[model samples]
Every structure is written in structure tokens, then in C-alpha cells.
Target: MPELLAHRADTEPDRVALVAGDEQVTFGRWHARAGAVAAGLHARGLRPGDRVALHYGTASWHDYAVACTGVLRAGLVAVPMSDRLAPAEVRHVLTHSGATAVLRSAGRPDTDLAWSATLAEIEAEAGGSVPPQPPSPRDLAQILYTSGTTGVPKGVGATHANLAHGCTLDPRRRPLAHSTHFLHAFPVGSNAGQTMLVNALNARAAALTAGTFTPGRFAKLAERYAAGTIFLVPAMAIEMLHAKVHTTHDLSAVRLVGSTAAALPPAVALQLAAAFPAATIVNYYTSTEAAPAQTSMVFDPERPGALGRPTVAADLMIAGPDGRPLPAGEVGDVWLRSPVAARSYYRDGDASAEVFRGRWVRMGDVGRLDDEGYLYLVDRDSDVVKSGAHKVSTLQIEHALHEHPLVREAAAFGVPHPVLGTAVAAAVVADGTLTAPQLRTFLLDRLAGHEVPGRVLFLDRLPRNDNGKILKRELRQLLDDDRATQ
Candidate 1:
């Protein structure tokens, strides 16, 4: 893989690289800023292989992109920390990663050993070409911190070779020719967004960053720029479908739509297929540690829950209770081995040993492969609910409830029980008056006796984290509170 900044400058120097609000920044200008950031960091007593923590958000996409890529160009590890983290959490990560300095916008002073530079100042300093550095394929490129549904997030250290393999999975690699425009609406500092940024850089595709993901605003950007590709999550997809922006904006230029981070409802996928009839709507199953592993390219209207087959570059296994690979059609823990899988966590040896079993990564997800080899995810291992003598997958129950025509969203969890040890409880977002009996009746045909939810809670909306995953821990608290009152 080419140094991200150098690759773009060499292939598409004059192409537009950034579109933020009303302003347009070309690859030439973006490259210059990146070089300047490298020079600034070097001037500040930073050295090769040193770590830099970026603690900024959406407004600094261009800045983050320049700084992060520049870090790579300068032979350093780029660590993108979440802006939502508490100051103490941020401090912990900075200390854990052993980052030499924290990069932020000009005003932030609360961080320890910080460096701030306005965009204009950074751009002015790097006027000439950045000297080429010899490429090392195994060099650490980024350390991304992702906290799943439970526990503090661990930092996954990814290498350049790992990212190169992930990029090759893009089916539209041919269409994403040099100078093609790619619009990115996700927060730049996120693993997903940064992945897209790196792909665009490697392919010399022009980069366009929206300030944030607002359905209406993003559609306007795609229409305005005639972008060819977009990456989003299901919530963003639902927002676009509901906003009716496709009708108002010219989305004909979009050739590919990739979604990850959370499950994309089949109903939502169907709507997107209709909206972008000519484009490929891909639902990729992967994580920050293991980038796009399995993806479904066929958006046929007939299939219900078809998450596609594995990409040629990824090696996936479905392991059962005995730590042996299970036969196709048997749901088990999803283990992935791929070129994109991170080497290990930074400085967290125990966590690394637990997650990284040799080259394969235990994704903490339960899934099975069909006879034809398409993978179907049932639930995460941590989300399974064992009640009395029965083992239940909460996601299976939730998906069944969501299939009910009256239900908009559904979440299922296990509630403690004295006799049965645990009872299945469900919370749903629905319209019309829905009684417990009616819900039970609706689920009777779709679920077995043990899988059915005993108690149903109705809510206007389900609580979700910043990345759009539902927060079941909060739901458990609500159930506990209600039980206490009763």
C-alpha cells in the first residue's frame, strides 16, 4: 500500500479531495496540508514510530485525514480516539498507547501534552514536496479503539498489509478509477470512515466529507458532487429512506452503497434496493479489528436474511463448543482469519491473547454458513440468554418480533427469575394498541415456546450508542426498575 497522501498526489493531484459545506478542497491542497502537519509534528520534537492521538470530531475531517496520513508518511502510528469518551478515558488511552502527543483543534487545552494548529497555519507551512520514505508493508498504520456492547474498548493495532487486503474486497475496484469521487458522511475519526478514506487515497479516488451524517445534507452532497460511492450504517440508510431525499436529489451517480456497524433490517435493505435500482447495496459483516470479511453483493428482492459469502481475501470459520469448525448450517462462534485482521491490541497482552488466537479472531458473534456458503449471524455470544434449561438467542427473538407488521423495532433481553433462573423480556416500538396477549399471539406462529418473550415492554424508540448499536445494559436497568415497583 502506498503512503496514503503520496498515493493520491501521484495519481490524482488535480482531483477534488474534500467537499465540506460549501467549500471544495482539491487533492493538491489536501496533500500540501498533510505534508505541513508532518513537518509541524517533526519540528515539535516528534520522531519516527512515535504515536500521535487525535482527539477531535466531525469538523476536523480534513485536518484529521491530513494529520493521520501524515503520521503514516512520517513513519508513526496514528491513534484515533473517540471524542465521546470522558476525559479520564481519553487520558487512559493516551497513556496506554504511549502516544507522544495529542493533536486537537486550536482551542483545546485540557489534554495532557497537546499540540494545536489551525487548518490555515498547517497548510501554509508545507509548501514543497515531502521526501519519499522507503515502504515497509508490515508497518503499523493505525490503532483504533472500539468498545463493543460491554467493557472498555481495546485498541486494535492494524498494519499496512492488513488494510491493503481489505481494500481489495471492494467489488467496484474497477469502477473506483483514479479521479472518481467518493462521498463520506461518517465521522472522520471513526474506524469505518477512516477505512473509506484510506481506500479513496489508495485508489486515488477523490474524497468528499460531509460535516456529519444528516440524510438531507448527505443526499445534497452526493447530488452536488455526482459521487460514485458512499458508506453508511443502517440508521443512516433508514434516515435516507424516510427523508425521501432520493426523490429530490440526483442519486443516479451512486454506483455502490456499503453499510456496516449494525444489522441492516431486510425491510430497509429492500427499500434501498428500490431507491438505487442500478447500484449495488452491500451489507458487509466485519469489525474494526477485522475489516470487511463477508459481504452480500446480490440485492435480490426474494431473499430475506441473506448476508453474502466471504470475499476471496478473507478466511472465515464457524466454530462450535468444542473449538472445532462446525459443518455448514450449524450456528456457532464466528472466527475470522484475514489479511485485514489486526496484529494485536496495543500494550494489552492479556486482552490480545484472549481475542487473537494465532491468526484467527474470535468475533464474539454466533453464526452459521448455508450449504451454498452464505453466512447468517444469530447473535453475539454475550447477548445469548439461557433460561432454565433452554438456550435462547435474543437477536432471533428480536428479529422475529420485528417481522411482525405492527412492530417498528424490537429488543430482547433476559430478566432474572427465581424458579426458571431467567425469563425472556422484550421491548418493542410499535403503532396501534398492542396488548401482551396480542404480541404473544403474533409471535406464536413465528417463535417456539421457549423462544417467545414472556413480558413485552413498549417504547417510542430503542436506546442506541453513538455507533448505532442498541444498549441492552440500559434496557436491563429499566426492566429491573419496573420489577422493583411491581
Candidate 2:
């Protein structure tokens, strides 16, 4: 990563590399500041392979960027922890990773973490040059903790090669080169944020983000920067469409719009296409462990639901219950083998063995690839509903619900039933007055009789995790509580 920065500094010293609110840093200045921070960290007794935790909120994104690069420059492993974490959660990461030092912004309350120092403090100690000890391709680079929606968060250790994938600096061959700026609103300590960081080093366009993100603010940035490409999660895309931000802002400069972190709902995907008529609306599907092995699709109006074929750098397949490869259209475990080496959970041999099988990584997602090689994700393995003798996809039901104009958000899961063994149930967030019978009638026109939800409940909002994924387990608990009261 440092090598890439040095190259950019030498070639485009005066070019703008990053823009966060009122701060715009040039490549030459960013390189100098990072080098100084590296020297200061070494002076403070940081050695090669040491783990340094970076804890910062989105508001401190500029400092987070400098701190992350400085850790890499100092030949230490960077461990990024989300500031949204509670004290207990922060302690867990610090203890698990055995971080020797921490870099954070000023004004944040102190934690029980060991040897914390603010960026200002680190800069104050900056002076002497540290001898270069550039990391090899196979050396550890970063340890990213999972969101832990299912259980305790586990750390995914990435090598230099793993994080540096697709970072060729050749301007003529880079992806999305037509864009003057690559705009995103992902918070710090996210996979999407790290991906944007990589773009900052390699892409022809400057990496741009707002200090704070609202639908209106995001649109204005796009207009002000004349951003050519925009990346967002499905939830953010839905918010912008629902709020009608495009009506008030000029987004014609955008040529490509991408969604990741979760599958884009078919209804929302269509709306995005209409809103960005000049842009190519795309959806990317991948996990933190199987990154760079992404399956992406440029939205096809004819096949609005398809996730694109695997790129040249990725090898994807569907494996059945017995672990044998399944034929086309057979829903099973989705596995990916990327040019980047597969990673394991830090300090957890059991999880490493379960998830990493030789060169391939189990994606923990259930999907099928059509004969034409388009991937269609069904649902998370744990969220699939078994009703009677049939297996139903909650994602499909949710897609149907999203087709309704009144439905804003939806989640579907299995509920216990004495007669059918299990029945399909759903909770929806909507603006207008909606009833169970009315929603069922609306679904009847779009879905098969068997595919219709058995119990339809209305709510103001659906429960979501920090990363914007629906919490199906919590939704089921809500159903249980309602059943007990009745």
C-alpha cells in the first residue's frame, strides 16, 4: 500500500488524492504526512508485525485514513475497529487481537485499551527517518473484524496481496476511469471503506466522501464534485429514491452506480436504473472473507434479478448438501476461489477450518447459477424457510413485497405451524395504511399462491444490523412475543 502511495506521489505529486469536507489533500502532502507518522510510531517502540488498533468514527475519516496508511508504512499490521462499538465490544477486539498500541482522534473518551495515543500526539513525536522494511506480498497487512450478526465477531486476517488486489495503477486500464471522482458514503472500518481506500491509491479519479452523509448531502456532493461513479449500500439507495433526492440535485455526471454489502432488491434496482438513466446500474455480491472474488452484474432490464457472472479473477460454484458440486440452477452453498489467497479467522482454528477449505472459501450464502452463468442468491442459509415439503426463499418473498408501492421495507422468515410443519411469515415497513389482507391481495397478483406469506404484520421499521443487513433472528423473536401475548 505504501509503495502505491509513493508511486502516485512521484507521478502526480500535485494531484488531489482525497477530499473530506473542507480538507483536500494532495498526493505529495499525504505521502509526507504518512511518512512522518511512520517515523513517530517507530520512535514510540512499534516494531515490525506489531498490531496497531485504529478506532475512529466516520466524522474522523481523514485522520483514520492517515492512521491506517501510517501503520502500513511502519510495517505494522493495522486492525480497524468500528467506533460504533460499545465499550465491551471494543475491549473484546483489543483483547482478541492483542493490539500493542492504539491510534485515535482527540475528544473521544478513553477506553480500557492498552497504550492509546491520539494522531496529534503521534505527529508531535515525528522527526527521524525509519529504515525501510517493506512488507512482502504474503505478509500480514490488516485484520478486519466481522460484524458478528450471528455470534461473536471474528477477525479476518488479510495479506498484502489480498488487500492490494485490483490495484494496478495503469490509468488507461483501470476500472471506472471515466469518472473524475469515485464517491461513496460508507463509514470507516467497513470493507467498502477499505475498497475505496484502495481506489484512492490506484484509480485515476480522486476518492471523495462527505464528512457526514444524508441523502440530500450525498446528492449535493455528487453535483459539486461532478462525480462520475457512485457506490452505495441497498439501504442508502432506497433512502435516496424514497426521499426523491435526484429531483432536487443534478446527478447527470454519474455514469456508473454500484451497490454492494447486500443484494439490491429487484424493485429498488429498477428504481435506481430509472433514476440514473445515463448510468450503468450494477450489483456486486461477495463476503469479507471471499473479497475480490465478487460476482457482479450490470443490470439487465430483462433479467432484473440476476447477480452477474464471476469475473476472471474469481472461481465460483454451488455445492450441495454432500459437498459435491451442483449443476446449474441447483441452489446450494456458494463457494469462491479468487486469485487472492483465502484467509482464516484470527486465533480461531475451529472457525478457520470450517470456513476455509484449501483454496476455496464457503461464502455462507445459498445461491444458484443459471445455465447462462448468472448467479441468483436465494437467502442466507439460516434464513431459508422450509414449509411442508417445499423450500421457500425469503429474499424472493421480500422482493415481491418491495414491488408494492406502499411497502418501504420487508423481511420474511419461517414461523411454526402445527399443520404445515412451518409457515411463511413477514414484517413490513410502509408509509401508507396497510393491512395484512391488503398486502396478501397485493402479493397474490405478483406471487404464486404457495409463495404468498401466511402471516403479514406491519411495522414502522424492520430491524437491521450496523452493516444494514436485516436481523431475521430478532424478527422471529418479535413474532414469538406477539404470539405469546395473543
Candidate 3:
């Protein structure tokens, strides 16, 4: 990263590198500021390989990017933490990663650390030269913590090579070659954010982001900047469609729209395709542990739900319960092997061993590959409900519910049943009035009798984490409360 910045500064010094709100920083200025921050860290006695935690309270993408680049330039491992994390969660990361110093934008000091500084303080120092020792490709780059909806979050340690595998300093061979600007609203300290950072340095397009993100705000930014490419999660895409941003803003510049971090529902996918008629809408499938090994499907109107075939750099397969490879059309654990090496959990060998199998990593997702090699996801293995004699995919039921014209969001789970062991239940966010019977009848036309949700409850909204994944555990608690009342 440090080397990439220096090269860009020399070759394209006057080119715009970042656009965050009103600030437009050139590559030359960005490199100099990062160097200043690196010199500041070295002055504080932080040496190579030292872990530095980056926690920010504001939505300043430029500052966050500078802090992260400074950590890399100083030959230190960056540990990015989200400000949305609770105090206890922050403490756990600080204690677990053993971060020697903390760099933050705003907020009270959340952890007991020997050294801490704000972004302003870090960029204030003057540095004349780069670090004497540069980081090697094999050296640790960043420790990204996964969103722990099921349990405690684990840090995935990515080496410099892991993050920079396909990244090239050559502008001729960039990811989005035709795009002039790539726009995204992902929060810093996320895998998606890191990927965007990589694109900012390597891609021909300048990285553009907003200080705050709402569907309307994002649309305005895209229209204002003439962004040729935009990336979002499924939840964000759904929100944009609901807001009808396409109707209000001129989005003709957008030639590419990519969705990741979660599956994009067929309904939302179709809506997005219509909204961006000139763009190629894509759904990317990959995880924090298995990045750059993505499977991208250019939204085919006929195969809207398919996750697409693995790219040449990736090797994807389905593994049965016995750990043997499964044939096409059989649902099982999805495993991915990429040219880039898999990352490991930081200080958690047991958890690492469970997911890593030689060069392949278990994606923890249940899916099947079709005869034509297209991938179809079922549900998270942990989220699947086991009834008396069948395994039910909550994602499948949720997708079906999303097909309802009035339904906005839906989450399916298994509730305890005295006779059947477990019964399917669902919580929905819908517009029109609907009853359990009505919903079941709606499903009967599309699914088997057992697949219909036994209990259907409506709510204003579903609980979601910072990454926009539904909190099933919270929904399960609601089911428990209803059971108690009965």
C-alpha cells in the first residue's frame, strides 16, 4: 500500500484520488499526509509488526483511509474497528488483538491502552522519508473482525499479498476499466470498505463516498459525481428501490451496479435491473476468509437468483456431510479455493481449524451447483432449522415471502414445537393487512405444505446489525415470548 501510494504520487500526482463530501484530495497530497502519519507513529515508538487499532466515530472516509494507509506505511498491522461496536465488544477486540496503540476520529476512549491519538494528531507530524524497512507481501497487513451475529466476532488476519493479490499499479488493467468514478457507502473497518480502498489505489476510477448515507443522499451523490459504478448490499439496494431514487435522480452514468455481503433477493434484483437499464447488475458471493475468490453473476433475467460460476482465479465446490465432494444439484457445504491463500483467525486456532481445510475454506453456507455450474445458495448452515425429519432453509422461506407484493422484509426461523420438535415461524415487515392463514395460502401455491410458515407475525422492521444482516437470535427470542404466552 505504501509503495502503491508513492508510485501513484510520482506518476499521477495531480489526479484526484478521493472524493469525500466537500474534500477532493489528489494522490500527491494523500501520499504526503499518509507519510506524515507514518512518521508520527514511528516517533511514538511503534515498530514494525505492532498492531494498531483504528476506531472512528465520524463518517470521515478520507481520514479513515489515511489512518489505515499510515499504519501500513509504518510497517504495522492495522486492526480496523467499527464505532458502532459496543463498549464490551471494543474491549474484546483490544484485549484479543493486543493492539499497542489506538487511532480514532472521535468519541471517548473506549479501551484501556497505553497510547491513543486522533486522526488530526496523527496527520500533524512531519515525516521527511518513508520507513527504512518496507513490509513484504507475506507480512500481516490487517486484522478484520467478522460481524458476530451468532457469537463473538473473530479477527481474520490478511497478509499484504492476500489483500493485494489482483491489485495492480498499472491503470491499464484495472477492475472497472471503463468507470471514471466508483461510488460506495460501506462503513470503514469492513471487508467491503477494504476492497474499495484497494480499488481506490489500483482502479482507473477515483473512489467517491458520502459523509452520511441514505437512499436519497446516495442517489444525489451519484448524480452529482457522475459515478460510473456503484456497490451496495442487498438491504441498501432494496431501500433505494423503495425510495424510488431512480425516478428523482439522473443515473445514466452508472454502467455497473454490484451487490455483495449478502444475497440479493430476486424481487430486488429485478427491480434494480429495471432501475439501471443501461447497467450490468451483478451479485458477488464471497466471505471475509475467502476474499478475491469471488463468484460474480452478471444479472441474467432468466437466472436472477443464481450466484454465478466461479471466476478463473477461484475453485468452488460442494462438500457433503462426510467432507467428500458432492455432485451437482446436491445441497451441502460450499467450499472455495482461490489463487490467493486463505486467511486465518487471529489467536483462535480452534475456530480456524474448523473452517480451514488445506487450501480450501468452508464458507459456512449451504448451497448447490447446477449442472451448468451456476451456484444457488440455500441458507447459512447455522441458520438452517431442523424439524422432526427435515431440514428447512430459512433463506428459502424468506425469499418466498419477499415475493409478496406488500412484504418489505421477512425473517424465518424454527420455533420449538412439542409434537413436531420444531415448527417453522416467520416475522414480516409488510404494508397491507395479512393474517397467518392468508400468508400460508400464499405460500401453498409456491411451496409444499410443510414449507409454509406456521406462525406469521408483522412488525415495523426487522433487527439488523451494522452490516445489514438480520439478527435471527433476536427474532427467535420474539418467538419464545409468543410461545410463553400460549
Candidate 3: the clashing residue pairs are none
Q: Please, what are the lDDT tens digits per residue for candidate 2 over residues 1-486?
A: 888898889889999888888888888988887888888899998888999999987767778888888889888999997688788888999899999898988877766667888988887798775735777878888988887878888998898888888787676776668877989888776788788888888888898986556799899999999999999989889888988988999999999999999889989999999999999999998888887678889999788889888875238888997778898989899988877787778999999888888768889989998888788889888778888888888889999999999888888888888988888899888878888888889999887777788887677777876567778778778875553211
Where does candidate 2 have its weakest 10-residue lDDT segment?
477-486
lDDT of all predictions: 0.72, 0.84, 0.84
lDDT of model 2, residue 282: 90
Which 10-residue span in candidate 1 carries the lowest summed lDDT? Answer: 166-175
Identify the superior model by TM-score, candidate 1 or candidate 2: 2
What's the true lDDT of residue 8 in model 1? 56
lDDT of 1 by residue, 163-275 (tens): 66644433355336623677767664466776666665655456677766788889988888788888788778866876788999999989888887876777777778899
lDDT of 3 at 436: 72
Off by over 4 Å in 2: 129-132, 416-422, 480-486
Where does model 3 exceed 4 Å of error?
107-110, 126-130, 480-486
Estimated TM-score per prediction?
0.89, 0.95, 0.96
- For candidate 1, the per-residue lDDT at 225 reads 78
lDDT by residue for model 3 (264-319), tens? 98888888999999999999998888886779999987887799988662388899
